[model samples]
Target: MNARTADKLATGMFWAGALTVIALLLFLIGYILYHGAKVIDWHFLTSPPTNIAAGGGIGPQIFNSFYLLVLSMLITVPIGLLAGIYMAEYAKNGPLVKIIRTCIETLASLPSIVVGLFGLIIFVNMTGWGYSILAGAFALSVINLPFIVRVTEESITGVQKEYKEGSLALGATKWQTIVKVLLPTAFPGLITGFVISAGRIFGEAAALLYTAGMSSPNLNFSRWLPTYPTSPFNPFRPGETLAVHIWKVNSESLIPDVRAVADGSAAVLIIVVLLFNILARWIGRRMQKRMG
Candidate 1:
């Protein structure tokens, strides 16, 4: 084929692939909404699960999911960002740095179930923290750390070298230049990584099942509070996360309406994830504009 014809064919194929992906995503979303929207209500969202026959709401589970997400992010972001900065700015392509990079890449690719098993062994069995929110958060942080590190490192590395050099020439120290110039420039990408990690942590079920035991929904602030008189240090408190609730309702329940409940929960979970993604993109764009 002539050069112009070849270019046209390549463009056609690229557009075709892109459209196919978009169509597939739309189809999946439409299917979930069609099946799930019927079951969603205030009661469905707020009520606790009842006997397997009567479908109950998932308010507690949703709350637990958010709780875990926030806790994990709190633990993972700072550690990951600092590590990323160290690797990007200070660590040359030396032996120790190469080994650490390899380890991060391998951890990122590891299976979720394997990570779950590890959590079960270390957090549940070894540490005796039982199945509490803290254990679940720890497990999630472990799963999310590699992604955060990789993203932060890449983002920091992408900052313009000239900016760093200029800062140094202006009598700024290495740490000052990094903190003031490089980190701000890379903030958008770092936020993008955080959003991705949040989505993954929200949907996580397996690891949480082991670390955060399966329990009925409860929002007893007195029991959960650290200083409350009734508060017990029960690490084995089976807190039901939203994802696990869906799985249990679908797989273990004999109720005819269980499928509807599961679909509704899945839809809500997807909606929450999409919101996080959109927020991340918006923040990234805003930061980019401000930096420019």
Candidate 2:
């Protein structure tokens, strides 16, 4: 083929592939929303689920999902940030550093089900925490940590070298320059990574199934004390999240409206993930504007 004709053919093929992907994504989202729309409502979101009843809601599961997201992020972000900073700023090129990076990559590539089994052994069996929120959060932290660390390292290193040099030339200490200049400059990317990781927490099931259990006890929303066993704030309590609820309903639930419940739960999970993505973009834009 002529060079010009070959180039045009390749360009057309790439456009076709891109359009196909977009179409498929739109169709998937539309399908889920359509199937679940009839079952989703305020009552469905606020009422507790029933074991064998026809009509039940996912209120506690929703609560557990958010609670676990918050708790896991609380544990994951700080440690990931420190590790990333160390890798980006202080770590030297050596065998140990290479080995550590290899380990992180391996951990990141682990299947969710395998992570669940690891959580079951360490968090549930060894720690004596049973299937509780704390165990789930720690398990999730393991899944999230490598991604966050990589993102943080990349974001910090992506900052312009001039900024660091300028700060240091102005007599700023290494720590001060990092805290003030590097982090703020990388804030947008970091937030994007954080939101993406947080969204994963909502969709996770296998790991949480073993660590957080398949059942959520009746929660006392009125009890604000974290120490209270029945309180939603109590991290020691068993908490089944929305993703787990969906799996349970579809696979083994005895409820008469199992299909409807599963559909609605899946829809809600998709919506929450969409919201997190939207929020990430918005925050990233705002941060970019401020930096500009």
Which candidate number has the best TM-score? 2
Q: How many clashes in each structure?
A: 3, 0
Model 1 per-residue lDDT tens digits across residues 78-138: 9999999998989988899989989998988888778888888998889877677778888
Model 1 regions more than 4 Å off = 51-54, 222-224, 227-236, 254-256
Q: Residue 188 deviation, candidate 1, in Å? A: 1.6
Give the candidate number with the greatest lDDT. Answer: 2
What TM-score against the true fold does each predicted structure earn? 0.93, 0.97
The deviation in Å at residue 77 for candidate 1 is 0.7
Model 2: weakest 10-residue lDDT segment is: 47-56
lDDT of each prediction vs. the true structure?
0.83, 0.93
Query: After TM-score superposition, what is the CA distance of residue 64 in candidate 1 from its true location, in Å?
Result: 0.4
13-127: candidate 2 lDDT, tens digit per residue? 9999999999999999999999999889888998998632555899999999999999999999999999999999999999989998998999999998899999999999899
